[model samples]
Target: MTFNFLSPVSDEVLAHNELLTPQALGKKLKIHSKAHGLPDLDNVKIAIIGVLENRNDINYMGSEVELDSIRKVFYNLFPGNWYTNVADLGDILKGDAVGDTYFALRTTITILLEKKIIPVILGGSQDLTYPNYRAYDSICPMVNVVSVDSNFDLGDSTLPIKNNSYLGKIILEQPYNLFNYSTIGYQTYFNSQEEIDLMEKLYFEAYRLGEVSKSISLVEPVMRDAHIVSVDLKAIKASEVSKEQKYSPNGLDGKEICAIARYAGISNKVSSFGVYEYQHSKDDHITAMLVAQIIWYFIEGVNCRVSENVLSDSVNYQKYNVLIDDDELIFYKSKKTGRWWIEIPFLPDVNNKLKKHTLLPCMHEDYLEATQGKIPERWYKAYKKNSF
Candidate 1:
């Protein structure tokens, strides 16, 4: 029924694969076309949905959408060694009003999540993330969002929402299903001090671009805890992508952004993902191919997901405790995957309390820091958040 909101992919785009590259993805993907309808949803793990709404983008000025351009490159990438059923569900034509488009996105994503399919959105603007977040309200009790971008996108909620400021809408909107929000690869120059303060005030996490480029593995913990990951392509360095995506001279390199994408895919919790801010322009191939590779890495990471690391079963994990000052920090290492988590102790006399000793994902480096009589930053942040 929800499929009613979707329009099938164009015949022209489907016909572009006629060049006969045997290994190209057009030869492999279960595409929605004039001849074949939507692929069966039963075992489908991923669905690609394109959107054309940009009226709320702030930068919108009758510009064409780049989703088809992205598809042109995506359809040509060779499939990797993987085992996930994927479907191209086609595009959601922009509604007369932007709100209508949001409604369509919300309803479509909610339906797919109900069927346990991950919707990989190719959006007209990053503002669409608001609807992606809303879709989780009925499917899950809470959600954790991870955004990989150079800017915070937390604009004034008093102002109309734009691609640059949609986080304001997501954080302030009703029903309040957001459990956590984190940003990776944020550059200081692009954000304001007020927004940085806002992040600290809310106990949200933000990793700077320089730190992330130095050590990419730090994102895994955040992704391990995310439900939705929205990537703004402007976060990538200009040299790696087409000029249209070049928002910053200094940003993440192509490989780093793709690695972040893969981490999002490897997360057991992440259900909905999106890449936005793509523009239709000359030399779109560079940006399109890069975006395609990022998607490929995400699928690869999904196939490479590890299990047998359930923390609730004590038999599968080893625990260690380190005391920093008067507080004792407990850490767990999974026997199967070697992943680490630190326990956030429940506070006393707190209403709406979390269960005792709730685990928060951490890296082995955090454990080492704790052993050195220092509290891991993640544990300290979680402890402060819990104390409130």
Candidate 2:
């Protein structure tokens, strides 16, 4: 039942190798000189959530080792005194029952969100996404999630409540507006036609590997709009780094993965981000280095964004909401003049459905009703109008 934060690496061993200690990792990655006009961390909060449990599928386990590698890399990369507040939340206690593990993760994530800290989760399996999403729900009722993966992750009717299709469960239980959901780098072989149909019905945006490489520009806006990002290691091609299930012969390269992480890091709206399904057992030294590189890129992006005051603009304003329906959720863009605008409708079949609606003056009751008391009315209206 006890959770251990530090890895098994002994200080003696690290000292002998002149490795950077965990305490020094964040400082080493600090951006003293602001480049790219990113925000500073004077008011920003950052936390790391590392999970070790790897079950449900063979490919999903043993990511804690990868996390350890990431920690070491960060320590070595950022050597100076920097970073506002960075701490490892520790690993979820293993040997607890399945429900216990889920609760543990959920509790940890909730704690971070309550403190308004951005959480970067190094996951044991893709199943971690479910709990991560649930934890965010406690703070923000509506979240725009962008998942980078190789599969639809929507398994058959059997209902994969495990590491694989927990996202499907999330989509089902949460009041999620699928219009805000996008699955990038999906491989056709790993996904079924029914899954695609379901995603279409749910209005989830998907881009195949071919399309992603051809249209990398499409990635920025998706990252810009998301509130959370769940990245699966399997999204990368096996030829690049092989570890997780659903590894594709054709996939994104290390540079592409780094770019995605960088984009996710700078997106002010993203409150929580996770990289999952990395199996150290199957990973080569190069693969481990690649994983470490990805984390480094994420840290670099986060530091830049914090230093640049990226979130300040939206701090006073409320983020938008997605109207959830059984079949689809709608996305609305708000006008500066205060109007409810439907920027993207949930159903794709609807033609030129984009329209603006005059929103009523902000009212406490309506605000409470719109976000179910999770957000303010003006913010909700503005979010619906696409202002934030």
Candidate 3:
């Protein structure tokens, strides 16, 4: 009944799949249709939806649905060993008001997450991430978001919400469920100094585009700690997506974006993911396929998911205690995945939201940095945030 608000993928668009081979994804996954109604939700694992709203975007305007074109390429690629039943639930058509579309997305995604169905959203504008973030309000007491974008999107929350500044809405709005916000691939020139200072001031994390490109693995730890991952397509280079807003000669190339997507999907905590800021084009097959491949990598990462599905057994981990500036730091290394995590001790005096994870995910390098008598920035941030 939650899907009552959704419409099926247009048959006219689906007809394009006649060109697909039997092994193509078009023939493998179940799809929502006018005839078959919705896909079998009983066995469904991931639900894909296209949002048709973009009026709030200052950088881009109008509703240009690109999901069908993206699907033309997505359904043709052979899936990896992914056994999850992925359903294409069609598009959330644009409403009379942008806020109406936001309501639809928020309610629909909230239902999906409650059903344990992860939503893979194809967006009309990056502002859709606001509703995507809102969807988790009923499900999670505290949510952490990891955004892969060239800019922070932290516009003035006091003003009307726009794609360029919806994050400010998320940060300033009521119910204050956001525990951590980490932005990957933020280019310095695109963000104001005040935004950069605000990130540190709030204990939020922001990585420069160059730093992430140098070590793509740096995102895995960040992703491992996220519940929602929002991606702005412009973070990718213009060569990959010609219609990209603020298309730049320099950005995360195709391979890097795909790698980041994979990390997002592989995260134990990341439940819902979205790729936004897409526009329809006359010759967008290449861009469509590139988005499809980025999605493919995300699904591939979901397939490669380990440790998260299984309960963490203490026997499978090695624990170490290190003292840094009198405050003892505890670390755990997962023998199975070689992933590291640092523990945050409970200070009863301080209100903490990390009751579920006193031991947050970390990189081995964080442990090494701590061993050198220097507190890792991540640990310090987490400590500072939790202490308050």
Candidate 4:
């Protein structure tokens, strides 16, 4: 029934798809259209869905959100050397109410997850992430969320949900499935001192914009543990986007944002990805192209994914143990991918969310830091959170 809510791709975009070259991504995708109905999703590795509801935006006017511009640019781009099948499931038009739209998105995402299809969502507002998170209620017992935003978005949970404050509701609401939440590229000025304190108090990770800009690789491990990765387009700097999408003078640039997308795609745990806070403008080619490139890089990363069971397989990884302040920190490095992970010691007494997954993704630098008689902040935080 929720599939019925998804409208076919616009005739205008379909007409444009006909003009694309044989090697273009549009020519390879199983696109849903008025003439073809829904495409067979069998063997499809990724499914693209557009959500056209922006009523929950804090600065919402009467204008509606559109994705045809991005879709057109995306379709015009050539595909990478990939073996995975992809599908465009078309758009989910806004329902009579915002809740109705959320319900439709939640159901559709649930179905895609059941079919082992990763959904690359084009969203109207960042608040749509709330529904995407809810779709995991029946799929996984615990979830980790990595939000790419300038603010913590922990708006007053007591107030009505808005794009700026959706995370507050997610943290306080039912199901209690969210185990850990991390923010990348956050600007301190946009968040309150209380919110910053709460992030620390709750042991949630927050990486500043400057820190991430200097080294984009820092996000890989954070993304590696995330199940849902939600990106706010407003997190991008004004110069990198169109006039309507210009939200901040200082944020992630085009290159940095695309790199983050690729990192999210490379993560084996990240199943759903969403880029939100889209504003429609007369000429949004620049923003559309950037978004399309982000999607392209993500697919490229997915294609390059390497499966490594570092815990179960010892032959593929090198192990190191460091003694720091009476604590023994164990580290594992994959010989195949050169990726590192630190072990979180299991405590028999405390209730733990990470009972099965003890290896926390880390960097070689973290192992070096532990060798210097210092504890890695990430391992410490994870250790503390697990003990809670």
- For TM-score, the strongest prediction is 4
lDDT tens digits, residues 1-388, model 3?
4676688888866787767888888887788888888887877878889887888878554446657888888998998888787889988988888888989999999989989988999988888998999998889988999999999999899999998898999999988999999999988999999999999999999999989989999999999999999998888877777564437777898899999999988886889999988777777777788889988888888878885422367888888999877799989988888988888777777677655447778899999988999888888898899877
Poorest lDDT segment (10 consecutive residues) of candidate 3: 307-316
Name the lDDT value of residue 71 in candidate 2.
54
Q: Per-residue lDDT tens digits of candidate 1, residues 1-388?
A: 6487888888878889777498787777778886877777888899999988888888788886758778888888888887897889899888988899999999999999988889999888999999999898888876889999899999999899998888998889898777778999999999999999999998889999988999999999999989999999888888988767777789999889888989989988888889988887876788888888888888888888886455558998999988888888888999888899988877767643366667889999999988898788877776776675
Q: Cα lDDT for residue 201, model 2?
A: 61
Off by over 4 Å in 4: none
**TM-score (C-alpha) between model 2 and the true structure:** 0.69
C-alpha local distance difference test of each model: 0.86, 0.60, 0.85, 0.93
Task: Identify the candidate with maximal lDDT.
Answer: 4
Q: Tens digits of per-residue lDDT for model 2 on 211-325? A: 7888675576567667778998888987887444336678888888888888787666677888887666544556666776776676666665632221233333344554444
- Off-target runs (Cα >4 Å) in candidate 3 are 60-63, 243-246, 308-312
- Show where candidate 1 strays beyond 4 Å: none
- Whole-model lDDT, candidate 2? 0.60
Question: Distance from true position, residue 298, model 4, in Å?
Answer: 0.8
| Residue 69 CA displacement from its true place in model 3, Å | 1.0
